[model samples]
Target chain A: MKRNSTWKTVHRYGVYNKSTGAKVSLTGGFGYDYTDGSTATRGFISPNGAWFDNPTVAFTAAAPTKAVTAQNEAKTPYTLSWAPGKLSKKVAVVEALKASGPNFFTAWVDNGGEVDVRITNNGGTYEAKYYTMGTSTQIANPFTASVGDDSSSPIIASEITSNKWLGWMHSPEKRTQIYWAGGASISFYQETNMSADATLLGKTNGAGNTGYTTLYAVENRAIADATKFPVEAATWVASTTDAYEYGRVNASADVRFYFTALNPPAGKLARTLYLDVNPAGPDAGDKAIMFNFSANERSKEYTSFAATPVTATLNKTGSNLRISNGHTSPWSLGIQRWQVLLTPHFTSGALVRLGGTTQ
Target chain B: MIALKADGTVYAMSEPMVLNYVHAASKDMNENKEIVFVKEDGNNHNPVPALCTAPTASRHYPGGTTDVVVCSVEPSDFGTKTYKLRYNGKWVNGLPDMEGRNSENDKNGFRVTMVNPKAGTVVTHTVGGVTTNYVLKPLAVAEAFLPESNAALCNDINFTTVAQFGWSMSDLPSATMIPTAIPNLGQSAGTSKFEVLGRQWRRISLSIRAFS
Candidate 1:
């Protein structure tokens, strides 16, 4: 192949395999010089024979082949139609098999008989053969899921040291900021390496309102597109308000809560794991403040509040937690405090549990 | 052509084929052949305790076997490893050319085989009326190797093979299902399939060896 040999510019060359009669297109517009021996073999253009009368079609020698070992089908390397290359442009889902030697090889499997076979001799001998596996299943990948930490919030980068490390910071709405490291309050969120202006993954209510006080990560079974998959996580926040003529209704009846990727696309649901938090409610009788956490529409009702701390634990798989509370009578004007420490252990039960004192 | 970012810094636009050529040039089969140091866990039901234990010194290889098998124990600390081999019924005490790309010998053959078979899955390969079961345990650091480390566990040592596999898009829509381009920038350019270029870059650097 010579550049401008016919006195006209050629942008691309379609290399035709003389043996199998398959066309492999190459993109080389100019400044490419091909000699008699410097052609590629095995699915590539080999120009050993007659020169190309037409500028676009380059005549090549017959490419070599390898004997197919049907039992070794598990190991053969091939290109899927989606990967970038000639195969990507094809309409049919064609798999182009590859064999590696000192030089790379490409082979097409158009019919049912063409099975991709790879053979290598350690002594660096270059030999090629082709065989047919007439009756066999197509190659398959074991796992489709691209697994990673799809955390609900932007991970506080400094808090990450090991795998599965969970970072928590109070939403910017809170005047008193907090960060959790190993379930311990490490420092104020603004003081840490994480910038105060950095945006969280999901929306957070502004200052003076009930916002996301806590956010944690959960593992999903499979994510179809890693680039677009939402982080599987939940946010919880508590609020305190003033009482009116009704007396001691100081705390609000609701807790701010949000779930990331709650309703994913069909057939791509995030694996549902249940959350059970103690001292939770949607009560109306005696409780003053009602904290309702809703997931899977499952509700837990607690009638009264004790000095005991608020706690969260994992229930059985494929379930959700919904906690709500109600206020019937009025009480004192003091603020109720809740500090929850959530720790996630990735094990059989797969529960994300939190513990903290309520006062 | 080059474009400048909002920060006024120069942006480098490279041809996709240049990346492919760079990847092809960087291909090396021996890249995976390295000593992975590990910290042995005591609770691991190691089938071959002798081979799995921390090696104070190199061990000897027994005679007449056509192949020598080596396995690196899991939980390695990151550098220390066993680098022992044998030749002609004698201990060579180092790694040799098991793949034999350069050296081919009648007696000496070495291989380090790491298998991630399902836990408790026993793989059996039989030859010459002798049957061997590869008992894969859950997080078992190293299973079986040459000269029969444990007779109670399987001693069969002929397990050296490597095959080149490819990337598969099981969940993505087929090429025929996707349109060539979208009408609007947000709808077409933001399509999931179009996002594969960035993801493919990660996949190529992480897993793909050059075709050669």
Candidate 2:
């Protein structure tokens, strides 16, 4: 009878029979011969406890396996098949029995036997292929149709043409030019002697014109005529001469003197007239002088009853005046000197004439 | 009567004898005589005598209650002698009456009197026949009327009457009596209602009690 066992016939101490839980000591001189030479004495025990010299048996360990389906017109890319074992473990496909390579692929173990992977040419003309991880095995289909390089990757310089690259440069034609407004030219100088013939619009040169010269000249015209024009100084008209006379009279009697030609000129008014009277002799206690014009003219009284040596004024009235001594008591007849004056009101250029009596 | 002779000699005779002599000499000659009296006060001691007319037989006294006397007589035997009254060390004339009677009534001299003297009483007296007026002024006594003796109850129970001897009670009396009973007797009360009363009796003594 043949019984399955797990035993090693080439151990350092001896050999162990896994099926029977038995260990044999190699120190005992149980010399047995096998196929190689006289020194090869390791062997296995048979089911009946008989030692067999041939220890080699037909045994193999199970390994993970995969099967692939070929690509066809309906399925352009090939597919890999594997049995569902430890579903929690991750399965990956690799090329050339390496864990990491350009053609490596990974997926969850629970994905079963179906997985879709996109292939790209990576900027090359050749097609991409899929393989299992850590094996020299490949899927059945080697794809020839390229899906192109990854669009997110950095682009090489040779990918863009010269004309397209030049579109990003700034154009000098779009630059702006600055401008300044024109104005009057003002000059500033620290220490300078300047001379120029400039006409100032609203300015004049003051008196002396010491340092800065101006376009306009100024002059003084403080006193001017009504027309605002300059003229010479004013001149005064001469006054007429005075008249005098002497007379005597009794007490309480009247003494009269007359100036009949006293008149004002045309376009002029009579301004004032002055009269003076002086008496002589001790018997004349008091005396007065009076003036009377014609009945058609105005009369002015110099004094009612006054002492001698009296001077008085008569304002402007269009009339002649008659000078006379007043009638009063204590007036003895005595010699008296009397003078009269008459003045006229006139304009700047008007002529004036005055006439009066002195007695 | 006194007479002046042509020889510039002065002579005095009896009024009857002078009258007879004037009648015998000439019918035109008449007797002329005048008498003047002076009075002085002892209080003022004025040197100048107050002139007055001669007193009649009935004595005339100066007004008011002032005493005066005529204490000096230099020639007492002469009937027409000059009499002087020393008043406050100053001599004043004291004229006798027609009967030659010029003695004072008492040792204090003459005491002038007013008939019914009272406050503001005016009396006229003729001193040496000159009439003068004197006004009598009496002491004032303040008095107030109480309506009832004990029937009217004073609002303040602790009230008491006051006796102000020489003081006057014209506007504010020394003690005030209110008819209404005080609500808060001898206790702190709101001052607003009693502030006027408090000012009215500011300088007086205050007592709050019930009294009848």
Candidate that would win on lDDT: 1
lDDT of 2 by residue, B59-124 (tens): 334443433322221111122211221111111112121111133232233221101112333323
Q: Score candidate 2 by lDDT.
A: 0.21
Off by over 4 Å in 1: A1-200, A214-353, A356-359, B1-113, B116-212
User: Using Cα atoms with residue i matched to residue i, what is each candidate's TM-score against the true structure?
Assistant: 0.14, 0.08
The worst-scoring run of ten residues by lDDT in candidate 2 chain A lies at: A228-237
Tens-place lDDT per residue, model 1, B114-163, is: 21223333223233445444322232223221232246454433345322
DockQ of each: 0.01, 0.00
Model 2: runs farther than 4 Å from truth? A1-359, B1-119, B139-212
For model 1 the local lDDT of residue B79 reads 20
Q: Model 1 - which docking category?
A: incorrect
At residue A120, candidate 2 shows an lDDT of 31
Best by DockQ: 1
Candidate 2: C-alpha RMSD after superposition: 81.4
Candidate 1 versus the native: TM-score? Answer: 0.14
